[model samples]
Target: MLREVTAIRYVTPLREGGSLPGVVEADDLGTYVVKFRGAGQGPKALVAEVISGELARRLGLPVPDMAVVQLDPVVARAEPDEEVQELIKASAGANLGMDFLPGALGYDPVAHPVEAGLASRVLAFDAFVENVDRSWRNPNLLIWHNALWLIDHGATLYFHHNWPRAEAVVHRPYKWDDHVLKPYATALATEGPALAARLTPSLIREAVDLVPDEWLDDGGKDAYISHLTARAAEPEAWLP
Candidate 1:
């Protein structure tokens, strides 16, 4: 397990992250892509990344290891971009880290280069489950050591925005066009009791608990917990 340590030296900000992600090196010699929480995107975004990434790994997806990291002023040399400096400063205390995938260029789904057909299937599962973050522009796919690696799964399940009365099942299960995963799409949609069983209440609870308190008020937390509990109970709606 990675230790919960505070303070990492910021190396450089990732140009693609819309002026928010600061790449850094932890004292342990691990490179990290750190994100701040002050963007009003909230801590739930970070929680989503950790939970989804971990769960996908359990389901046999190749996700790089991830952890929350703290940024120290002594190490980071950040000049204000003037546009979003306040948000950055406010989030100074709540920085997050994604274990960096060095020497990897962003994946272009158009090229369909991911050799692992399984990755496409897994990503299809992600899409069917309504993971809103994995788009072609910021596919969050990485290529490391000649193997496809996935990262940054924070934006997902956007329906939570409306706070509709939590309903688990939508009539049609994901059709899962295999073409979306290969030379066309590599992953095929698969359904099984085992994968369904994996999305448990305890796991959801734990994943929700990982979010920082500052991001959610007591009421928000209670509502999220309630909704997640209900959602987990009807696992077929999500995993199928």
Candidate 2:
């Protein structure tokens, strides 16, 4: 289970993507970028966030710490935006919270060149998870303390959205031409296999186990575990 915290205040809305996740202060005295369950993408987005982010962390990739934030809705009373207030009101229970990386800057491939090994690992991991959001136009990455950190994984594991065809897409090839880090992921041939070898069934389950029960109302836990385990078992078909 993830660390649980109650939202003490809604600091500000981060209007980056469609979900409109906000910066919030929690009872734990830590700031987080909270992804509301009521967002346009719904709870599945939060599910993806937890599974993908935690999996990336287990793979020795940099990802912000996550928590199950308990939202009261009343915390957003002072917000001037009606949309934000409604979002909070609708997501009055468990939501996803990521440790806010203060002072982090958006990643610019040219400005911050990544090493080939780390880049390869990230690309391979993204491919394995079928994350399509790390494009150059919208690199959902950050540079904090001069290190690359992955974020906004709500777009991953998209096969879950259509359960009937999940098996068909599980081994779908990853198109990396526009991947933000593709240029630097030169060692993918070697690094990709090395990373795939680490994604044992146990490790994948450990990542899926982090998701909260409420989010799995569809009883999709076993499905996620099986899907990822199957995908990991055949990295050659998907690795870019």
Q: lDDT of all predictions, in order shown?
A: 0.59, 0.93
Q: Model 2, stretches more than 4 Å misplaced?
A: none
Q: Please provide, for model 2 over 1-240, each residue's C-alpha lDDT reduced to its tens digit, 9 standing for 90 to 100.
A: 999999999999999768999999999899999999999998999999999999999999999999999999888999999999889989999999999999999999999999999999999999999889999999999999888999999999999898889888888999888999999999999999999999999999998999988887564699999999999999999999
Task: Please estimate how well model 2 matches the true structure, expressed as its whole-model Cα lDDT.
Answer: 0.93
lDDT of 1: 0.59
Which one wins on TM-score? 2
Q: For residues 1-240, could you state the per-residue lDDT of candidate 1 as single tens digits?
A: 323446556566677875377777776788877767765677666656665666676666788776666654545446555434454566656556777877887777666555445654564547434565555646677777877776777676444555553444332244333323434442334433345556676665565566566555444656656665665455465543
Among all windows of 10 consecutive residues in model 2, the one with the lowest summed lDDT is 211-220
Candidate 1 total steric clashes? 8
After TM-score superposition, the amount by which residue 187's alpha carbon in candidate 2 deviates from its true location, in angstroms, is: 0.8
What are the root-mean-square deviations of the candidates from the true structure over C-alphas?
Answer: 3.9, 0.8
C-alpha lDDT (0 to 100) for residue 46 of candidate 2: 95
